[model samples]
Target: MMEFKRKALAIAVMVATSTLTACGGSSSSSDPDPVTPENKAPTAVTLTANTVEENAMGVEVGTLAATDADSGDTHTFTTDNASFVIDGTTLSLAADASFDFEKMASVDVDVTVTDNGGLSHTETLTINVTDLLDYYDFVSEFDAEKSSVSYSGQTARHALIAELKNYIGNGGLQSDVDNGELSSKEEIVAKLNSFYDRDENAWDGFAVTFTDAKQKFFSEISSYKSLKDKVAGNDASGQHALWNGESNEAGQYTGENIAFTGWSTWDDAPAHVPADGVIPQKTPHGLVQQFFSQIADNAMENPGGKRYIHGAEQIEANEIPVFVNYDGTDLNQLIQKFLLMAVTYSQATDDYLDENKGLATDNTGRDKGEKDYTKLEHQFDEGFGYFGAARNYLDYSDNEIAGKVKTEEDGRADWNGKHDTDGDGEIDLFSEFNFGASVNAAKRDRGSEVQTDFTKEAMDAFLAGRKLINDAAGTELTTEQMAELLEYRDAAVLTWEKAIAATVVHYINDLRGDLDKLKAGADDYSFTDLAKHFSEMKGFALGLQFNPYSKITDEQFVEINTLFKDAPVTELSEIDEYQSDLVKARDILQAALEFDADNVENW
Candidate 1:
C-alpha cells in the first residue's frame, strides 16, 4: 500500500506540473486583441478680422488652420466670397477685388477649413475698407465753374470805342480842338488830364495808350477838320455833311465826327482843296477809330445791322452798352474774346507781322534810350502780356497755376482768380485761360515721352521767342538772329496749335463719356443739369475758333456754329448731331496738327 501511494503521489505531482505548464502556455494565445480609439473631427482655430485700404494689392486676411486628432490627416481651406481666395490653409483677398469706400465700407467673408476625414469648420471674417487720401478738390469746382459761366454779346471792344467817342465829345477834347486853343498835339495832351480829373496813372489799366496814340489821333482829326473848314469857307457844316454822306448830319458836331466812309475818299480829300490846300497825315489810331466809328454808325442806322461791333452791343447809332471798368474787370464773353483777339489777331498778326516788320531789321534807325523796345518787339511783348505769360515763363517746370481761388477781387471768377498764381511777380489777365489747356495736355500725355517732348519743345520755343524780343530792346536783330527769331515764332505757333488740338480731343472724349453715362442712366441728372453739360461742351467748342493757328475752315466753322445755335439743350440725343459734327471737326483739327486720333468715337 505504501509503495502504491508513493507511486500515485509522484504521478499526481507530475500531472499537476504538466497542467500548470499547459495553462501558462495557453495564456499567451487566449488574450483578447488590443482595442483602438475611433477617429474625431478637426478643431478649427478662431481667426481675427482684418482691415485693408480700398484698391489695396496682395493683402493677406488670415491663415485658416485646423488640427485633426486622427494621425496623418491633411488640411484644405476655401472662401465663399469671390473677393477672397484660399490656398492650402492660407486665406487672402483676391488680386482684382474691388473695394469702394463710397459704395460699401466693409465686406464679410466665410472661410472654411476641412480635414481629409471630411470634417469642415466655417468662420466669418469681416474686412474693413478704408478710403484713399485726396490731396486737392480741384476737379469739382472747375467743372462747376465751367457750367455756370454765361456768354453774351459784344461788350468789350465796342464799349472801348464808345467810351473814346464819348470822352472826346463830352470830355472837351473836341471843343478844345474845334476852338483852335488845343491846336498843337502837346497842348491837346496837356488838356486830357483836365478832362479825366486825374493824372496819367489813372489810365494805367486802359489797354489803349493815352499819351502817344490819343494825342496823335486828335491832332490828325483836328488838322483834317481845319482843312475842311478852309474849303467850305463858313459853310463847313455842308462839308461835314458831304464827308458824313448827309445821314449823320443830325448829331452834335465834335472831333468824333470822323467816320470810315472809304479809305480812298479820305486819301483823295486833298484833291477837293485848292493847290495851296493843306494835306492831312494819316495815323493808325485815327484810322482804327474811324473804322470803328463807321461800324457804330451802321449799327445806329439799321439797329439790327450786320455791322456788329466786336465787344459791345449797339445801344444806338452812336452808342454802345458800356461797362464801369474797361481794363479786364468785365469778365464777359465779349471781353474774353476781345482779349484773345488782341493777342492773336491785332498784336500778333496786324502789328507784329504787318506794321512793325520794318523795325525788326532796321539796325541803323533803331529806337534806343529810355524807350528801349523796338515797335515790333513791343508789339510782340504786348501780345505776350495779353496771354498773361510770365516774363520768365520757362522757369516753371509745370503749368499748374497756384494760388487760384474764388475772390471778389479776382473780377467775378472769370477764370478762378486774377491772383498771381505760378509764383510769378505780377497778377496777369488770362494767365490760366488757354494756358491750362496746354498744361493738361502735357499731363495727359505724360506716359508718352514723345508727346511730352512736343509740349516741352513748344514751351522752349515760346520762351526763346520771348527772350529774343526782350533782348532786342535798344538794338536791332542781325539777319541770322532775325531768321532764328522767325523760326522760334513758327515753332511756338505750331506747338501751341498742337497743344490746343490735343486739348480739344480730350474734351471731346470727355463729353462723349459723360453723354454715355447720361444715356446709361448711371447719373441721376435733371434736364437743367443736362443743359449745363451741353453748355460746357459748347464753350469748349467755341474755344476751337480762338486758336491762334486755327485749323477750322469756313465750312467747318459753319457746321460747328449749328451746334450752339440751339443753346441750353435738354436731351442726350440732342448732342448726337453736335457730337457728329464735333467728331468731324476734331478729325480735321487732328489731321492739321498731325496727331493720330485713334479709337475716337462719337459715343
Candidate 2:
C-alpha cells in the first residue's frame, strides 16, 4: 500500500510540474508560446558556467541541465564525447569532464543537454586561457607597426587622411598660422604631418609642387620668361605689373641700404657727392642704415626664409608695393562684384533691347537675346544663396578689424578738458577733440581732429604737406580736412569689440571653406581612392576653384541680398545669432567694396 501511494504521488507531482513553471514570461494573456520536452521550440535560455579555482585540488566538474515548462521531464546528459551527464531532477557532469588548469594553458569543454521531452541546450566553457608570452608578442608587434611602418594601403591611409582633413577643415591649429612659421601651404601641411613624413610633399628632394596646377603652370611660365607678363597680363592696364615689380624687389638687388635709397631724396641729390666727388655710389653707410637698421633682424629664422625690409613698407607709396597688395578679391568679393555687374549689365542690356525692340521683333541684325552679362548679375544670389548668413559671418571675423586704445590722460592733457575722455568725472576741451564730444555740453557736438583756433601759425606747417582728392560725388576737399574726417571714421571702426567679433567671423569662414572643400573632394573622389592615388603627389587634383554658373532665381537673389543687408553695427556675439549677423555684415562689406570699387571711402 505504501509503494502504490508513492507511485501515485510521483504521477501527481509530474502532472503538476506544468502549472508550477512560469516559463520566464509576462502576465499578459498573449504570452509567447512555451517550449516542451516532447516538441522543443527555440525558447530563450540563459547559460551558466562554474569552475573550482577556489579549491586546493585545482580541478572541478561543471554540470548543465535543461527543463521544460509544459512537459515535466528530467534532461538527459551525455559524456561519451566528454560533454554532459543525466540524472533525475539535475544533470550532473561525468568525472572525465573535470579540468586540470594548474599545469595546462587552458582547457575548453562543450556541454549539451537533452530533456526526455526533447528540449536541448548547448554551451562552450573556456578555462584558464591566458599566457604572458602571448601578451609580450602582441606588444612587440604593435610597437613595430606604429614606429617603423608607413600608413600605406586603404584602411591605414584612409584613417590618416581623415584625421588630417578634420584637423584642417575644423581650424584645429589656427595659432600655428598666426604665431608660428607654419603659415604657407607647404609649411602648414608639413607641420600637420610631421610625425609621419616631414618631407612628404617634397618632389625628388629638390622641388615642391603645388596641387593647384594653374599656379604651377604660371610659375613655370614665369620661370622661363618674365614674371611681369604672367602677373600684369591679366588686364590691359599695367597695374598688375606694378605688383610683380614691388614683390620681387628683394631679388632685384644684392646690396643692402636698398631701403634707405629713397627715390625722392636720391633723385634730388647732386650729380657728384661731396665726399666721394663722383655720382653717389652704393656706400657702406646706406647699406647698414637701410637694410640692417630699418628692418627686423630676425626675419629669416625659419626654413621658409621670409624676411622683413624697411623698403617693403615704403613700397605702398610707390609703383611697386613693399608688401603683397590686398586687391579686395575673394569668394565674398567675387560674389558681390558679380552681382553688381550683373545688375548694371542687365539694366544696360534692357535699355538696349527697348530701343531695338522693333529689330528684335523683326528678328534681324542680332536682336541680342538674353545678354550673357545680364544673366551673370544674380549668379551668386541664385546658386549659393543656400549658404545664407552663416557663410557671410565666416568672411567677417573679429581679428580682421583694427583695434585702438587711447588713455584718458593723453586725452585730458591734449585737449582743454571739455570732453569726458574716459567716461570718468573729467572734462577735456579742445586744443582739438580726439574723437570725443564735450560731456557737459548738450548739443551733441561732433569731435574735430583740427583746432577751432585755426590761426596762420597752426595752418602754415599743416597746409604745406597736405594733398586733396575728390569726394564720392567728385567734389574736392582739402587734404587736411579730408584726413581729419577719414581718420575719425577709421577710429570709430577700430574698437576692441569690433576687432574681436571680426576675427571670429574670419576664422569661421576659413573653417567653413576647409569643410566645404573636404566634402566636395570626398564626393568627387572617395577618400580611399584619393589616399591611394594622390597620397604621394605634391598637390592634389581636388579642384578647389570657384566658378559661378547661371540659372539663379529672383527669390534666391533676395535671400542672398538679405545676408548683407542686416550687418552688425556694434559687438557681435559668439553664438549662432551673432554668427548670422556676421554673415550679413560680411556680405554687406563685400558688396560695398566691390560695388563701389572706384570709391576709396567704401573700404
Candidate 3:
C-alpha cells in the first residue's frame, strides 16, 4: 500500500513538476510579465505675475514650476508675448525688450508650462512701467518764470519795428527824405529824434504818431517789470532800457533817452540807412516800407506759412526775409543785434555795474526812483527775452520747447545749419541771420547744472550774476564783494568772447576745408558754389566786425575783408591761390583773439 501511495505522490509531484516545466517552457528563459502602471497628468503650474519699471534690463518676471505624479516627466516653458522669453522653467523679459511709460504704461503676458506628456498650465503676468522723469528730483528746481523771460526780447524787437513804422507813416521820414534834409541815416535819425522830442503830429497817411508809438514801445519794454522785480528793485525802464538808453559809460543810466539808439548802433545800420555823409543801398524808409509790404504780401500768398524759419525747406526768401543777415544786414539783423545786445551786453553790463557800484542800494536816487525793478534785475530778465527760449527751457521732455535747448547738429530748431542742406560749404541768409544766436546759446549752455542734459550756460551765468546783484540789492557791496562780482563778470565776458572767436575759427576751417576739397579735384565745383563760399566767408567776416565791445579791431577787420574778397573766382584751379592768404588771416585771428586751436575745436 505504501509503495502504491509513494508511487501516486511521485506521480503527483511529477505532474506538478511537468506543469511548472510546461509553463516555464512556454515563457522560455524570460522574466514574469511586468505589471502596467496607470499614467498620471502633471499638476497645473501657478506663476506669480511680475512688475518692472520701464527700461528695466534683464529683469526676471517669475520662474515656471510644475509637478507631475508620473516619474521621469520633463517640462518646457513658453510665453505668448514676443517681449517675454522662456528658458526651461524660468521666464523673463527678452534681452532687447524695453518699455516706455510715455508710449505704454504696462504690458500683460501669458506664460505656459508644458510637460513631456503634453500637459500644459498657463498664467498671465503683469509688468508695470514707470516714468523716469517722475522720480527725477531736478524737475522741481527748474525756474519756469525765469525761462519765460526769453521771449521778452522778441516783444521788444516787434515794438521797436512798430515805432520805426510809426515814425515813417507820420511823414517825418518821407518829408525829410523827399526834401533831401535827411541825406544820411544819421541825419534821418537826428530828425526823428526831433519829432520824438516835439511829439510830432500824425500825417494823413498814418494810424499813430511817433510819440504814441514810443509810448507803446516803452510799454512793451517795461512789461518785464514783474520778472525784474523778482530779482531786485531799481527801475531799469524808461530811458535806461537797452533800446532807448544813452550813457557815457556802458552801464550807467544817464536818464537821457537817445531815440532809436538800437537802430543807429547796429552793424547793418550804415547799409540799411546810411550814417551822416554816407550813401545807403536802401534807405531805412524804403526798407521799412518794403518789409511791411513783403510781410503783407506773404500773408496773402502763403496764408498758413510759419512766421519763423524752423528748418531747411522753410527758408524761402520772401516768406521770412527778416530771418537772414546777408546782402548786408536786414531788419531782422537789426532786431537780432538789439536782442543780443540786450542779453550779452546791456543787461550783462548793467549787472556788473550794479555789483561794483551798489546802484540798487539807494534806488531812490536813480531814474524812476524806488521802483521794484532794479537795473540789474531788469537787465537779467531782458536777456531771457532775447534768448528766444520757452519758460521751461530745462525740461527736455517738453517736446514743444525742448528743441530750443538742443544742439544745432541734432536738428533742434537750428535754422543756421539747416539752410546749408546742400553741403555746398555755403549757408543761406537764413543761416547767416540765425547763426550768432545759436552759437551764443551753445556757449552759454556749456555751464548748465544738469550733467546729462544740455542747458543754457550763458543764460545760467547771467542768472547767477543777477542773483548776486539781487542778493545785494538793498545792501552796499564791500570792496571784496565788488571784486568778486567783477571777477565773475570778467569770466563771463571771457567765455562769451571766446565762444565768438571759436565760431570765427570754425568758419575759417569750413572755408579752408572747402578750398582743400577743390584742390583735391572734387567734381562739385561751379561758379555759384565758389560764390556761395565767398558769400559765407564775407558774411562771417562781417560778423567779426561786430564782436562784442569791439574785441575785433579795425586792422583785423580790414585784413579779414581783404583776405576774403568778393572777387568772381570761377576757376577751380584758382582756389589754391587764396589758401595761403586764408591761413595767414586765420593765424592772425587766432593770435588776436588768443584762441587755442584745441580749445576752439571744442567750442
Candidate 4:
C-alpha cells in the first residue's frame, strides 16, 4: 500500500508539471522566462484580400483575412455594416439574394477585433467594385492611341504655327531684330539654348506670360467698338487683332496687333517670372513653391485654377454617372478616397511644418526669451523626417513604383532590366500596374495633387528655414544640442508615420463594413447582386493576390510558411507561393511600423 501511494504521488506530480509546461511556465532554473500576457494589441494588425474566387456557396466573390501579433488569443471580428458573420477564424457572407453579391459595391467599414484578454484593435477597410479594363492594359492602349494620333500629321502644321506664335509672344525670338543682344550665330544659339534649357517652372511661367498677354490684347479689342467693326472681317488682320471673323467687314486689312503685350511680366506673368524676361528667373529648385502658390490660387478661383482647371473642366464636360445602376453602393466613395488622401497629405504637411520650424536660424546666445535650439531641431524633423513618412505612404500605392519608369531627365528608366529595386525579375507594383479604367485615377499615378501638395509645402518650409539659418551667420548649436535635435527629428518622423498608419487602418475598417453587410444576409446572398451594388468600391476592389497593403518580397514567404504550418486544413501549395512576394513586402513594412510605434517622442 505504501509503494502504491508513492507511485500515485509520482503520477500526480508528472501531471502537474505537464500542465505547467502547457501554460508556458519554466521547468528548470535555467529555463527561459514564462510567457507573459501582453496588454497591448497587435503591433501591426492588417486585413488583406486573400481570394476572389468562389466561396463554399459557389458564388464568385472576394475574401479578406485579419491577423494579430498575439497568436494564441481568441479574437472576435465585428464590423459597422449589418449581415457580417464570424465563424471561428473565418468570416463568410450568407446574404439571401442572387443580387446580394452584386449589390455589394463600394463600402467603408470600421473593424474592431478584441482578443481573449479584452484588448481591442481597430482598422478600416474600403471595398470598391466595378468592371473596368485592367490598368496596365489600359495604359498600353492609351499610349498606342496617343501614338497613332500623333502620327496622323494633321496637327503638325498647327503645332509648328503655335510654337512660332508662342516664341514671338514669349520674347524667345527678338522682338526688335536690330536689338544687339546677339552679335553672332553662336551667340544666338547660346541664347536660344538658355531659353530652351530654362527650368520647368521658368518655361511654364514664360508660356503663361505670353498666353496672358495675348488674352489681354483680345480683351482690349473686344472692349473697343470702333476697332471691333474694323476687325470684324475674316481676314488676316482680324485674326491677328483677336477677332475670329464672326462678320464680314472692309476688304483690306493688315496683321498689326496680332502679338502685343499689355503690361510688364510682373503684372500679368506668374510670380516666378521677371518683368524684363519672359521666363521666370528663379532657380529650378524654387519652382515647387511657385507651383503650389499657383495651384492654391486656381483652387480658390471660381473659374478653376491653372493647376487642375483643365482636368476639372474636362470631367464636367464628359461626366458619366458611375452609380446609376448601383443600388447597394455609394458612388461618392471614390470622392471620399480622394478626400482622404488629400487630407492625410495635408496633415502630413502641417506636421512637417511644425517639426521643421526655426531649423535654419541663429540660436547662439540670443535674447533671453528666444526659442533658439528647438527651432532648428524642429526644422530638421519636419523637412527630411516628415517627407520620409509621406514617401512611405506614397510607396504603399503602386504609383511610385512606376514613377521611376516615367521620369527620364537623365534618359534612363528606373526599370531598365539592370537595377532591380525589388531584386525580383519583374519591376514591382507601380511599374506593372496602371489606373486603366479604375475610378481612382490619382491613386495609381505618382506626383498626384495629394503628394505634390504636401511635398511642395514641406520643401518650401524647409527652404525658408534654410535661408533663415544661412542668414543667422555663424550662430550654431552646441554638440549636445545638435545630437538632441537629431533624436527629436527622428522621433517626430516615427510619430507622423504612426498617425498615417492609423488613418489607413481606419479606411480598411470601413471596407470591412461592406463585408459584414453581405454576411448578415448570407442565406439569400447573391454574389452577383452584391458586386453590382458595390460599384463605388471599384478602386478598393482588389483581387486577393494583389492587395495594396501586402507589398510582398521573396524572403517573407519562407518565414510565414514555417510559422503557420501547424494550422488546420492542409492546403499550402495554392496560397504559399502566391503570397511569398507579398510576405516580404509586409515584413519590411511591419518592421517600419513597429519602429515608429515605439518612438513615442511625438506623443
The number of the candidate with the highest TM-score is 3
Please provide, for model 3 over 37-113, each residue's C-alpha lDDT reduced to its tens digit, 9 standing for 90 to 100. Answer: 76566666656655666766567777777667776778887777888788776777788676756457888877676
Q: What is every candidate's alpha-carbon RMSD to the true fold?
A: 20.4, 30.7, 14.2, 29.4
lDDT by residue for model 2 (1-603), tens: 999999999999886765556464346546567684356632322234444331122233434444456455555554344433444323334543433232355555555567655666665555453322110001112132431111112112212222333343333434444466455555543444331222334312221121211222222211222111111111112221121112223333223222111112121223432333221223212211222211111221332333222233533232211111121111122212222222221211222111122101221111133322111112211111111111111111111111111454322232322223234443211111111011101111111122211111112211121111111112323456445633422222222112222222233343333333444544442222222211111010000001011122233333433332221111213234434643554454335223222221211
Runs of candidate 1 with Cα error greater than 4 angstroms are: 1-346, 353-369, 397-399, 402-450, 453-455, 468-479, 522-549, 563-569, 572-575, 598-603
**Any idea what lDDT model 1 has?**
0.42
- Could you give candidate 1's per-residue lDDT for residues 230-251 as a string of tens digits? 1111122222122222123444
Query: How high a TM-score does candidate 1 get?
Result: 0.38
Best by lDDT: 3
Clashing pairs in 1: 154-311, 154-312, 155-311, 155-312, 156-311, 300-317
Model 4: per-residue Cα lDDT over 1-603, one tens digit each: 999999999999999989887987665547765697666574433544422222122233334344676677777776655534445545444462121122244545566777778877777665444422111111111132321001101111112222333443334433322355544444443333332233333332233222222222222212211111111121122121222212224422232222211111121334432222222212111221222233223223322111121223544332222221112322233222222222222222332233233243434432233423233433343233213222112222233323334555422464222123334554222222221111122221232322222222322333333333333423575565545544543443343333333223222233333344444644543322332223223212211111112232223423432322211111234333423432343344346455233221111
lDDT of 3: 0.44
RMSD of 3: 14.2
Displacement of residue 119 (Cα, Å) in model 3 is 30
Candidate 4: count of backbone clashes, pairs at least 3 residues apart or interchain: 81
Q: Against the true structure, what is each candidate's TM-score?
A: 0.38, 0.16, 0.41, 0.21
Q: Total clashes, candidate 3?
A: 12
Per-prediction tally of clashes? 6, 33, 12, 81
